[model samples]
Target: MHDSHSERMSGSETRAASGLALVFAFRMLGMFMVLPVLATYGQDLAGATPALIGLAIGAYGLTQAVLQIPFGIISDRIGRLPVIYIGLLIFAAGAALAANADSIWGVIAGRVLQGAGAISAAVMALLSDLTREQHRTKAMAMIGMSIGVSFAVAMVVGPLLTRAFGLSGLFWATAIMALLGIVIVAAMVPRASHPLQHRESGVARQALLPTLKHPDLLRLDFGILALHAILMASFVALPLALVEKAGLPKEEHWWVYLTALLVGFFGMVPFIIYGEKKRQMKKVLVGAVAVLFLCELFFWQFGNSLRALVFGTILFFTAFNLLEASLPSLISKVAPAGGKGTAMGVYSTSQFLGAALGGILGGWLYQHGGLSTVFVGCAVVCAIWLAIAVTMREPPYVTSLRLPLSAAAVADTGLVTRMLAMPGVADAVVVAEEAAIYIKVDSEKLDRTSLESLIESAPERAEA
Candidate 1:
């Protein structure tokens, strides 16, 4: 039997994946760097309030959520690089605006503008264009890892940057980062030779409704939404807890974050290894959610103690890192073949929307009720998510395949039927417009020789 397996990436693939991952890291660092210190810094700005501070912290998410899908769609129409170019410019402008802002509302406006860039989907689409189907998952994972690393770095560095240059200076640094991203996009990233319709890459309008209605996908989407919501909401009060309740000075906050993040990263490894090696993803996922719930509860019960806060922070980051890494993998497995792009677009939107809601909700709870209320709200959300997660089916082991087709084959219904009938082929979609076929198959069982022979024998049809 011919196994449908991926090979080690080529040098070009490594370069492309790494460069783009760095691009994502720079952008994410800019956003995350503000998260740890924004609450404290906002207090000094004119018209500052707890609610508005939360809004400012999360305002970018609102614009990002609203624009991510549209940006992906636009990339499909106009090409990926152009969309990325525009987005980087917008992000740079937002960073500059934030850097110059003197009031809380001004910062909020800047954050909103920052969110408006909404290039994540476009960036992923470009990655798909640049890489082979077999290597795409690795590319995606690189980007995911970059985001996680950026978060850790940002948590540790945000305080130091604020101490050195102040909040406005931090924004200036982000603007510089954005400019650097633009340069990387232009020079380092490879260009696609032709405009390819990547069913696994960019959003398809027709696929949106079906993708959204998928029960399993919906569960994952809601999981990410609740996860990020709790994250944003918790941060609204966490810094305050550190400063006021734990008596940690602002400058020393990095020590706590560095310690917690290191512990969390180490703690997440075993679960990841066990889940992947033993095929216990569902069990691991449920456990992570439950741990997240308990982390919040711990925050509520031990909000005033340094040791408890340290322990809770460690647990919180462990769960966060695990979920962050796992959710995209699950989505890729669970999403219908050929609709991966649309499914991911929706997933990204949900993630950002949750951040926005978390900020708004967390701020409100903190303003009216207190940190305890924020923790309680986060716990409630996690509990509901955990309930939903319990009913989810374990995702099957599978991978996507994109095969080029001639124009004549595009019209051949029999070709699709034959492909679908092949053993280990779980789903097959023939997109005539794209002149390609997309398939999902059990990699271990797939008969690649038969499939390749069939494709080799098919006559090429002339394009119109």
Candidate 2:
């Protein structure tokens, strides 16, 4: 809400955000590549019974969900870069293990270790620290954009790489890319020692409950989980259906993926513009979810036809992109401004867990219930998530103001309480060590000079 010039991204913050984006994209891109081919590839591996194979495929997600928050908390206490470096190193080890696995168990072990490096939460926290509160959203948007780009690229290239070098080669390539990412992070990011008093490294103990209690926030979180679940499940079924029902060759699936990604990307622009520029985020979000629901229904009935699969897949992705971009923006608009980073952490965890559940459940359903059941199950999940989202209240935009305080001023709880009552102030948190007061307020109401006047007279400081 506040247009204070403080929100502008400084040059250093921009470069730091860019580096963080590369880390997120590189890590995610590798994981996504397996989605397109896992079910098919698993069938050919020697020790992969159908049941065990799904476990192997989905294991990475479970580990990632379990570790992300802890990893983030560790970064807060230990240093973001160090934690990140450890994660990348673990990821590289996992990659090499998976690359050389002769049995399904070995692949599963690799996946579990890979999940252990879960650095996404840490990466996000670092971005927040690097930029001013005013520029936080833009910095976050860049991260979101990077993830979208990575997923798109992975989808397009996966099948081609599978054809060119086989699945093992994909793992090897990801390993190499991760090591390269480690080099980038260590060499490019600033490495000054942070005083323990000046920075937080570990996970916040209070993250989950507050995030879960907010109805609007909960709705968005549920939607993300459902959205990613649908994505994971559909890929499980789509490629096999394409080859078996539609008579497309396996290698040529890339042709379809490339076409759909390119087109779906362009198709999402109008909805994004409408949501942001026209203030129609809710309307657009609902419409996209509705479209995706119908696409699932259509796929259930007609996915056997190549043309029908192509049309349905394209529609699914277009709606997915629209919802994905819109949801995080909506979260920023709605979250209690003081707790945005925490909210995102919870949201990210739910999504990774949902993807894990989807892979296992979808695989089992495919093995037992066949095509009709798998499609029906995912459609029902989407329909329920849609109902939950439609009932949420829309949120107003928020802006934060930060006031630098003297070390002595940081100890005055009474002074901090008084500032919370100021006109337009909604929430306040004072970090004494940094002499910074993070305040949420109506974006339209920032009066910097008056706010500074208040800060100058804080109880611990002499009124000047």
Candidate 3:
């Protein structure tokens, strides 16, 4: 079970994973760093309005959602590194444009431009190229953890940056970070030796329709859209609520964010453990969404006091962090073997679209009906997601693994039958062209020794 040789990542794998993680962190940090302070400080811009400000906050999502898939598709045509380099340059340009803009619409344009540089799928593709099939999951996890950290850091740091240097300064700082990301990519990250199109890793254009039509996958996609919409909408009014309703000074806002995020981060750990270990994912997911609903209601009704606002913020984030982590894992669990990448692509698009919708919708509600309406809107969104979650079938607790298969094993008509007969092997597919077998297995019941022995015996059987 603890074979070091089989488990340990090679030196190059470690470097590649770490470098790409840094690149991801840098980009996400820049994107998230605006969320906390934008609604409050963006008023200083010429032509700034609540609606336009909200548009500015969410503009990136629109272009990002539109272009993320296309960028990835083009990466396959040209190359991963070139697409990444071009995306980073575009991101920097957008940041620079925003930094110089004195008007809200200018910032919105800049944000849209920033979104145009979408590179997430390409990055994932490159990561898949760099890592062996056995180590790819761990590498992907590394990137996911980096993103979570970046979000937390941004929440705390964004307010402080705005307080000290104003909105323009923050944009300037993001530009610098984007430029720095380019340097990291060029200097630190290594190129993939064999950039093959992996069905488990890269979206297969032909698989798009089926992935989209998958009922469970569609529900999950809607969940992300609603979740991000709730997030963006809530933030549209939350800063103003903290300042005007709670009487918290603008400069000290970061303290509240830091405290709430810390609570959210640490508080959700137990629930996540319970959910995964107990195999109660659906229950946990529904419970988290319910908590979100209650939190929004609390804000709507009792958010005037500083303590109440802080409490509500903490609760909201606790649920948010839980859902944020759970949704992707669920997507992976629900996706069919050899179709995970396509499922994820759709999920990512829904997430960005939700952000865009939330921003625009939050702004409209705030302008027309005030802060309370924003909360109510988010609550309504949560209710819809809750309904969807309740109807979803309990997801199987399985992990996907890709094992190399010799040509002999692939030629065996009994290969699939034998693999499927193994305990814990829920699903298996033989991809002869890649000389590999992709399997979904329940780790708790899997017998690794037996599985490896079966594969090792294949070549011998062929010779016989």
Candidate 4:
């Protein structure tokens, strides 16, 4: 009857999306605020060793990677709100523990506990529960933007907070943020009247095997893992380099990050536009990885000068942000129809594991071979990723849609055949139990008016 995609988000839908985005932002802000300052101040803890400090930096990722999916599955059984409350409380407690800890081991324990909260999947599931299928993509995109902003803000804020309040105070602030997230959940977030498992939003058990075995998806996963490994490892040395080589003081570090992040954020926009608009995503991705390789090399060779540190940091983030933004979009493109959530779940887990690996790699290399060694190690990792990324097939530029279907449509045995026969319909899945259809379509080629007309026209019912 009407263009299904044309519907705007209702007031309730808008509220739900915005509130959940805030919750996501709060949690991530807490997780990331430590990245910039940890290396400089972490050494003050009792019995702190470089390796152990690295562990402290990455400990949360280990637990987060393990528990992320389990938390979502658990929410499916117990309900979304309860799981969110519990996650926030656990996160707060962990932050408090770290704030009070005196030894490196204790801080590591705190970080592990912090990661154990693992509520990202749960939050996304909740968002899915609250939004209409037509608006779900937009809702999810809002959450994604919030995360990117949170990371940028954290990088700038971390140094400022650490300098003003010290390490313990920084942890305490994260604890407060977690507690605040609980308040937002209770006071602001709307309750989902019915929570359904969405193949596009929540991980599907049946979809996991195929998603994991997907060669291109697997390559992308490795790419994220390598990307984060470089991030953690680089951060482990970056602060030290700034202080020792650039002769910058610890308190002034925020200025460098703020400026670099600002430059990086703006610098990547043209590349993103070129990639998406020009349909040269593979070229952009490969080129970004290559830039990453060179940036690491620059850091290893000439990072001792102040200008090099600043310029190199700016270049590094430009490439880093581009890849970070590109990888998820690529995952969406590469994943099978109806398996986006599962593919993303696996990709996220790989990312966390990489964070853990990078921390340890950075620490050991820095300790044994000095600051340059960390860059060397990160350069090698980027080199490997560059090699792998070059072989990726050109992605199909398509938009994914999950639409609620009428019972008659669900019962129509030939519904998929009819849709697939459409000019721009790339893939379709009729999941009867979920009372919905998942589709991938080339936006440029798809005639939305005709497609909707066919869907509403009539269904060829299966023979009873």
C-alpha lDDT (0 to 100) for residue 221 of candidate 4? 99
Query: What's the CA RMSD of model 2 in angstroms?
Result: 3.4
Candidate 1 vs candidate 4: which has greater lDDT?
4
Candidate 3 Cα lDDT to native: 0.90
Q: Kindly state the number of residue pairs that clash in model 4.
A: 0
lDDT of 4 by residue, 1-464 (tens): 35444578988889889999999998989988989988889989999887887888878889999999999999999999999999999999999999999998888898999999999999999998998877987898899899989999999999999988999999999999999989988888889988887898779999999997899999999999999989999999999999999999988998898888899999999999999999999999999999999999999999988899999999999999999999999999988889999998999999999999988889888888989999999999999999999999999899898877888888887888999999999999988889888889999999988987767764544443
Q: After aligning candidate 1 to the native by TM-score, how far in Å is the CA of 187 from where it should be?
A: 1.9
Which candidate ranks first by TM-score, i.e. highest? Answer: 4
lDDT of 2 by residue, 70-154 (tens): 8887787777888888999999899899989878788878888888889987787777677665676678778889999999999
Q: lDDT of candidate 4 vs native?
A: 0.90
Cα deviation of 329, candidate 4, in Å: 1.1
Q: How do the predictions measure up, each by TM-score?
A: 0.95, 0.89, 0.96, 0.97
> Model 3, range 295-406, lDDT digits (tens) per residue?
9999999999999999999999999999999999999998877788889999999999999999999988998899999999999999999999999998989999888777
Work out how many backbone clashes candidate 3 has: 0
Q: What lDDT does the true structure give each of the candidates?
A: 0.88, 0.77, 0.90, 0.90
RMSD of each: 3.0, 3.4, 1.9, 1.5
| Steric overlap count per candidate | 0, 11, 0, 0
Residue 232's lDDT within candidate 1 is: 89
lDDT of candidate 1 at residue 45, scale 0 to 100: 92
